[model samples]
Target chain A: MNPGELVPAMSGRAWRVPPRSLVEVIDVEGSQTGDVFAVPTDDLEDGLSNGRTFDYGESIRLTTGSVLYSRRSRPLLTIVEDEVGTHDFLWAPCSQEMYEIGYGVTEPHPNCLDNLTASLGGFGVPAATVTIAFNVFMNVAVGQDGGLAILPPATAAGQSVTFRTERELLVAVTACAATTANGGAAKPLRVRITEGAGSPTQGRA
Target chain B: MNPGELVPAMSGRAWRVPPRSLVEVIDVEGSQTGDVFAVPTDDLEDGLSNGRTFDYGESIRLTTGSVLYSRRSRPLLTIVEDEVGTHDFLWAPCSQEMYEIGYGVTEPHPNCLDNLTASLGGFGVPAATVTIAFNVFMNVAVGQDGGLAILPPATAAGQSVTFRTERELLVAVTACAATTANGGAAKPLRVRITEGAGSPTQGRA
Candidate 1:
């Protein structure tokens, strides 16, 4: 796949990934977390449910071969390739409130919640219904005492994780705006898409 | 609290808890998990978000003084008394799909998802909008390798966890229907409500 399609810093984009196709999310500038969300093209209510995925998958770590499940207990996507195996499922998309409360930012801030909602808003998924994300290149660790922390991802520049869509999926990916989540800064990413081995490249920030 | 108000096994109930009032969820028959959900009384859109609670609280364990947060980053309830400190926020409410897929049960099984939705259906929150819950008296542990398991609760018969409602809220509790969640048996629960010392006790599974 080419260097992929650019998703600007602190912004998002949505596109349709053909069923049985390969879709890769690339960390163009490393350590920038991407909030990944997918809902079936036809229905937004049945969105990614981390509760179901972890319940069925039996492991919190989603690496290669991990099948992402939906709220209705259906497989939505399969992780076929992973360069950064340590992704995060423990966080909600960052919000303006998070900035104000956690970072003491008084002004309006661009955040993944708004980005994802707006990106999928054109596709009819309302802001309230937006599901919690699967964070690409975001590292999370739970301590022996059950303390959860967001650690900087070990993903390097140009590395990527690819997925196989179980069906035609409306996928949205955002370069997360939370500085605390992405080491100490936010950067861009890319997305590459192809139908099969011989298919032309169709696909980030 | 007079043994609380009964919530039958494999079912649920919903009621308005006055702001600042003390409400207790009693695992009447012991080892029963009550899937707890709360939404602002006037707004169904802002519901329980375990992710937010854990994100801000920094721990998976909920006990006395733990405040339950809403999806919008608002505090909805506060745990004032917890006899069983190991409540769970990890698992989604059990469903028929779990019965069929995990246990090979073919019949339409009574589950906490349906029970919660049905109990709160009268309040106008559509089944599709019901959020993942905070499980009362449920024990869940994560292993060193990030393996998640549902273990039997340590709450004995008649033990209860009390909460202080931060606002007028529509609180729902269901006796979890999954046998795996409740030490291999589905059992009833109760709710006890009290305004203050010397006040009338009002409270279930």
Candidate 2:
């Protein structure tokens, strides 16, 4: 990596590490978005520090105005608005390398990395600033057996999520690990974005 | 948008497109990743003249040997392996202005388009070859009153989708959208990418 270059922000609530100035993700066709996802820009490590445990409510049990706390015992993000039904908190990001290795070098369609860079450049954010992101649409769960399982049926379609800004930050969002394993390989989804109306929604934006 | 540059093959199934191409995008987590997805190569388009839909059993969908028919009704690509649950027929690509305007610049984060350019350059893909895309993960269902309504329960986590290449191609992926409306604004998720086995789990790879 270059000295001036930065990795992209994580996809889920971890994005709160350096939370975007404003954030929004839409759920086209009966998919649910996250209710409370947040991070602290001041301490990205705190967002996803090793051995940290943040109590997450069941994706199916989430309600409006859900407050999400970080493992660091701080306010992360919140869920101010939700349409559709609920959002998933377990999906992963998509990437080109993964696509190539997972599928083959010849696999055609673009992956998440391709899309995020373009958006970053368009916003005048230097490509060098790209960092790992925190995705809000995915559903990664910890099973009772200590296994990391991405729970399905976590979200409904037409569900939207809004993240208000606590500060001016560059945020990134991607659809997710829409693979045959995750049950999103059939149809693409629709995501929309809207600004926050003063109050920060789930520490998102 | 320039013609002098060499672009990646664009296809529905992905594998049918040219190899080693590039794609660009703006937003992610905020809106649907498919809201602005694309397929830009001509040769890649010519390959998928026939329609091939991957319909896996209820537990999983997506045919590895089948091909995709792009919006232009052209052959997009082929499925190499689908470790994820399913691939979508309706996702959109990510964008920037969409985020700034739709999500409100107040707390705006990096969209897909921005991410695309950066990723392309990072991967050594010329910027000229990259182009914008249409939505891939989204669907706008028709309502009884002829109005459009968002479908619920769109995607699940741990779903991995992989495409195989019949030709060289470029690709991009983002998880964030700029739209905060519809309740998509909450927290960000985590997106990661890794290489997969060259062999396709379905058969094509």
Candidate 3:
């Protein structure tokens, strides 16, 4: 099914992407972090693993042409078109506990974990299946001394990154919980899915 | 076709592996490094990339259940079994130029690149397809300060790591030019391929 929806700032949405479909994530308002997570529609255990993706990609910085791998080390999606060159490969999805610990906030705090789980729940994906996610449009840098710093996004409004799904997938995305965690107003992000040129039953059939 | 062969130290061998096959690499001699490389049988430009594997795996160290990804971020192979838990993911295959720069050695020094290219050439694969490889049985450690140190192999003779091919692959292996690169006698390594549980034509066909 094709979907074009706006993940309002501090919120998320989940979609079922068929094989060989293209999922485009757009930074609608710019400078807003969009956390993207995916799992195979049939196997939650074989979902996207940021650690494995990083280990396989051999870099924490992703660009156009980078492949996002699943926990099983199979290609789940490929970044075919990238409008924003910088995206974060480090850092886990910010959870409510992290918000409480880092920002002294209580429940009802907007967090990625909660948003992702809520969105994915509609697809029968369990909460525990949500692990590390890609922080699109987020600019986190590593220093010469291995120190990591979170900086404002370098992407401008309307910039986007398009990923071609290599497998049938359940994808969830959040506009980020900066309203509580980073103390900034959350901005909206857009997602568009289209049919890819590759055959739907090309691989893993 | 399933084949078993020995790659002598200071030498290399290449094989064409059908999809859904397993390649078992045995460290026949203890403390010897075995360099392993692979490319899609049809495309040399899509050879294995260690950087992408590490980035996707999100770890520098690999064990059973880890995937070996190609430069295009697709799964070429998966580690199905590991007899020796330790494997080197930090350093690229040693080359003749590396020998000259690091050890003051001149030409004729056995190196992984030459061996891999020579082996792959037998199958019509060009020299340019010899990309980064996994230095199996080699021990490299990351220090607290992010420094990398190549140490002697922690694996004993007869230990092995088995990888299952996810796609049609052309695999090359070298017994490592240890004589000049590591100042040690190079020993023989064994490569054995067998059919995997997954159907041979499950993906590409």
**Index of the highest-lDDT prediction:** 1
Cα lDDT tens digits for candidate 1, A26-80: 9988988998888898777778887778878777778888888887777788888
TM-score of each predicted structure versus truth: 0.93, 0.34, 0.51
- Measured by TM-score, the strongest candidate is 1
What is each predicted model's overall lDDT from 0 to 1?
A: 0.82, 0.35, 0.73
Candidate 2: where is the Cα deviation over 4 Å? A1-24, A32-77, A82-92, A103-109, A124-131, A181-196, A200-205, B1-205
DockQ of 2: 0.02
Greater-TM-score candidate between 1 and 2: 1
Task: Estimate, for each residue in A1-205, the C-alpha lDDT of model 3 and write its tens digit.
Answer: 4557888878999998888888889888777888899889878756676545644455566777777876455688888888887787555677765556456778768778789989998888866556457888777654543335567887778889888888889989899887522226688889998865544433321
Candidate numbers, best DockQ first, in rank order: 1, 3, 2
Name the docking class for model 1. Answer: medium
Candidate 1 similarity to native, TM-score: 0.93
DockQ of each: 0.59, 0.02, 0.03
B67-165: candidate 1 lDDT, tens digit per residue:
788878788888877888888877778888877877899999998888888888898876766658888988888888878888899989989998888
Q: Judge candidate 2 at residue B10 and give its lDDT.
A: 19
Model 3 docking grade: incorrect
Highest DockQ model number: 1
Q: What is the lDDT of residue A134 in candidate 3?
A: 81
